[model samples]
Target: EGIENTNYFVQTSKKKVILTIFENRVKKSAIPKFMEILIFCSKNRIKCPKPLADSKGKFINEIENKKYGIFSFLDGKSKNNWNKRDCFLVGKTLANLHNKNLRRSFKLVNNLGILSLKVLYNKLKHKINGLIPNASKPISDEIKFLTKEWPRCLPKGLIHADLFPDNVLFNEDSISGILDFYFSCHEILAYDLAITLNAWSFFDGQFKKEFFNEIFKGYETKRKLNKLEKDKINLLLRGASMRFLLTRLYDMVYVSENELLEKKNPIEFYKILKFHQNLENINDYIK
Candidate 1:
């Protein structure tokens, strides 16, 4: 269940629903918290799925030692490429999600926090060079540099750390729904924005300036970024890239080369990381 939580769509009389089977990749205890996040977002007028309980009024059901959940499917299609307008709306919507105060607290530590990232890095430190050919050096150096550089005193809040394009659904000019909140957790809010910058603006191994500025502009329309968040965002961007790179590297190495599973290239994030590492000021991204 490393990356294999299976989700299937089921048609209902009125609308579609999604049934998710929680694989071992996700700890079972976090299911309740996930349900809470979705419900919280829905209550706040965000376009997201509402968790549906089974006939027993249980959100999480058990069968054969596995957990199951149901969600009302949102009516929109996921986007592979977003225009400038879509980026703006996504940015504003994301900021709105961050600024929202949930009615209750749900505590699940960020699995991709600095400490966890380091642990993953160390896990691959030995076989990295042999496995990927000249990949270990930059990862090692990035981890060391980020440890010394990434800010720890930034403002923290709930964040959907995995805000990639595929996880977002579009309806005409707006984001109909934000999907995939499994990575939601309490973390530095600015770091979450940084992750989006890396995901939304950086592409094809290059950073797009126009898309980057438009997103920050829309984000400011909802909640303005303070000087500290603006200044250290580059460091956050680099760290986010490293986090992804290490995770992808681990996935690539751990899986047998002979297996039929498709392996994603870890080097793509490496190029993005290298680009962000060279930028000095946050103004380079947002201004």
Candidate 2:
């Protein structure tokens, strides 16, 4: 009875349970890898929905030619109206998660840029050819730029990688839980921050200064940014926007029937890109 990705809610006399059934189409390698990451995040005090273990203490089960897993239901609601505090908390949480010393225990997940961008580009390039008018050249140019720039921006770490509002649960005024660890991976901390900032700072293609300040303030509380990191943020934000826009446009044209996945408007990121283009310095909002 859940809305997204073959999920079910089971109510028993003792407890309520959530069953997430993974798609069989996904690579066999992805199952254990995803489970390991989720388990690690939960153990690390990341506020993720707790994975329930079976009698054997295994967190996942195989059934019906698909994978199923149970998680404790987090109690909270998604807020439409966001403030500085919320932004700050989210930013701080992300920083803490990225900064944790996983050491050599966690296997680094690769192909993030490829999976999030390059693969999708290869699939959509022929279909979107000439259909979007002037969209092609800029999109192509951005892909080229990001391909080179992403690696140079930062190194890999444990990142939520997808921290949109819908993926978070808040109780009263603070974060109660984080959900959807499917996109969790080893990636650039700044890249993760960029994704979060793009989602948290701006609204409907417009920059919200207070919200931006709140998030940055919150993040800096846990992890201070160096001058180089600060200098790169605006451009990184533009890259994040383009990454999202590309994914959204591809999904809109190719996978619109995925009713469970919330479709994002590409134009919103485009607006953010244009807004930054007009700014002379990234610190304009920080102060």
Question: What's the distance in Å from true for residue 282, model 2?
Answer: 2.6
Which stretch of 10 consecutive residues in model 2 shows the poorest summed lDDT?
101-110
lDDT of candidate 1 at residue 220, scale 0 to 100: 88
Please, what are the lDDT tens digits per residue for candidate 2 over residues 84-194? Answer: 889989988877777763463555574446336766777777755454556666666767766776546455667776788877788999898876666666666677788
lDDT winner: 1
Top-TM-score candidate index: 1
Clash count, predicted structure 2: 0
- Give a tens-digit lDDT track for model 1, residues 1-287: 11246778899888789888876657888988988898888988988878998788888898799998898887788776777787788789889998884334556699888877778988898888876678787788878888888788887788988887877888777788888788888888888887887788976766788888878888889989899888888888888888888877887879776544446788888888888877888777655
Q: What TM-score does each of the candidates earn?
A: 0.92, 0.86
Q: Give the TM-score of candidate 2.
A: 0.86
Candidate 2 regions with alpha-carbon error over 4 angstroms: 1-4, 24-28, 101-105, 114-119, 126-133, 151-155, 256-260
